[model samples]
Target: TISYDCDTYGNPIEAYYAETFTPKVALYDGDTFIKYIDSNFVVWEDLRRIDYSYGLNLKTAGCNRKPDNNWDSLAKILNPLTYWTNVYSKDCYSGAYSLSSSESSLPFPIMNSSNVNGLSWRGSEDGHYFFTLLVIDPDFSYCTLKTQFSVSITGVPLLVSTQFLIVLSTTLAFILVLAATYFFHPSKRKIKPL
Candidate 1:
């Protein structure tokens, strides 16, 4: 439904909606402008949100920290022109949700990344925006690999718990098997040859 294209600097270039032939959203990532997206696309626009929400309003402190203001001041406090740019420069993977080398899935090389360049709002109560970038190989089996970026409030580390679950389950199963083998022998007793 939604498709996206990003440059090496991590700025969104083109966004396409499924229903139409032309791209509904066009992002301009220049010094004069940071993020200019078209919200008219139907389905593709919806998919773009999956990544767009990240750059919407991620705030951090120190450099562009603004206190005594709400999210309304986000654009002023942070450079809306380079706001999304900051979100895509991180090297941490927080919300990739699924990153694998399988053909059925997108082949993303860069798992997750975060950026130190952030902005702050709400009296700096909320930190800057945290960004995660994913690099897909795009040659996987049944899936199309593509480059995508995710934006979130600064300091929100991407928690990966599924890998741990699988490891724990495997360990428990192995332990249980060992216990059963120790208590229940499969081999029958040999008869004495007179």
Candidate 2:
């Protein structure tokens, strides 16, 4: 996602995507977490973790979900497009998501520190799979934002269409030829010692 700084009037003051999420909130920031500051200037770190209150579970026993101190996990859902954040943290002025496979472990940065956004998954036969990401802090009160994406998977052998007969026939023919050649090769025997 891109970044841009805005003035008090909410105008674009600067724009760039470095290797981290800007602690200072901006006019149009593309991140998941939204930070808020109260009258006392105590950046109210009211970030939410995964919404596992429901009957949803994230990791298994051996593998536990990681948590971030800068940002907090707001919600967890089944989405294939993007990985979701399971934990969030705060650091005085700013905060971010904790994208970890286990407690306290963080994934490497592919784009920037803010790159860690959220956790998501797709319905798989083996059950389900998803990755966790970290989200940058934000202004949640006046600024409400959400990141969304989609994914599509195909080629389930059990769900093959009847029209796949053409391809199957070609594959079978090729395999038959290979088997015939291997078993009935002309080099069945070589010249014996004189």
Candidate 3:
């Protein structure tokens, strides 16, 4: 979250306390701060490595691009904060995952948009994901963001191999051939099941 994105009174447009209590991501266009949220809630605070010391630095360069960094950094470079902004590549094996928040992460960002106009992933990752956001107060003084909040993001599925696809195709082809032979063959033979 940034200074310009907050409402005049200081609450984010995505801050919903009625009906159901939930914090949401805010989207900005030009000078207008609008409320935008979906099934998955991502809280992104850009520390931007400016305060890099031990493990509290937030970098924007991207994770998988660099091999020297740890898996946590590489896997979550564009996460939580920017993931809701756009659709991202779901490749997690090579650890080359990336996402874009400015664009739609889902196929049609505009189609699945909420009232504030943001993209929503209908379990695009296949797994259920809960995120945590670390918020720090302004004036560089005391803070209450030490606690992490859970989000509504979904997780992705595991990677499968081409061999599996080949096997499945072969099995389906054999079944189709057997049915074709039974129905179209001249003798119309019937074989009993074992």
* Runs with alpha carbons beyond 4 Å of true place in candidate 2: 1-88, 92-102, 106-136, 139-141, 152-194
- Candidate 1 to native Cα RMSD, angstroms: 18.9
Over 4 Å off, model 3 = 1-125, 140-158, 162-194
lDDT of 1 by residue, 1-194 (tens): 22334342254322222111122223434456544232211111212222322112222211122222232244446643233222322323344333222321221112112322211222212122223322222222123222233222233332358668888899999999999998897768788999
Predicted candidate 2 versus true structure: per-residue lDDT over 146-177, tens digit per residue: 32211122332333454488779989999999
Q: Give the C-alpha miss distance for residue 122 in model 1, angstroms.
A: 17
Candidate 1 vs candidate 3: the TM-score winner is: 3
lDDT for residue 70 in candidate 1, whole number 0-100: 30
Between the candidate structures 2 and 3, which one is better when assessed by lDDT? 3
The top-ranked prediction according to TM-score is 3
User: Cα RMSD to native, each candidate?
Assistant: 18.9, 15.0, 16.9
The clash numbers for all candidates, in the given order, read: 24, 27, 10
Residue 57 CA displacement from its true place in model 2, Å: 19
Candidate 1 lands at a TM-score of 0.24
- RMSD from true fold, candidate 3: 16.9
Worst 10-residue lDDT window for candidate 3 reads 49-58
lDDT of 1: 0.31
List runs of model 1 lying over 4 Å from the truth.
1-3, 6-164, 179-185, 191-194
- What TM-score would each prediction reach against the true structure? 0.24, 0.23, 0.26
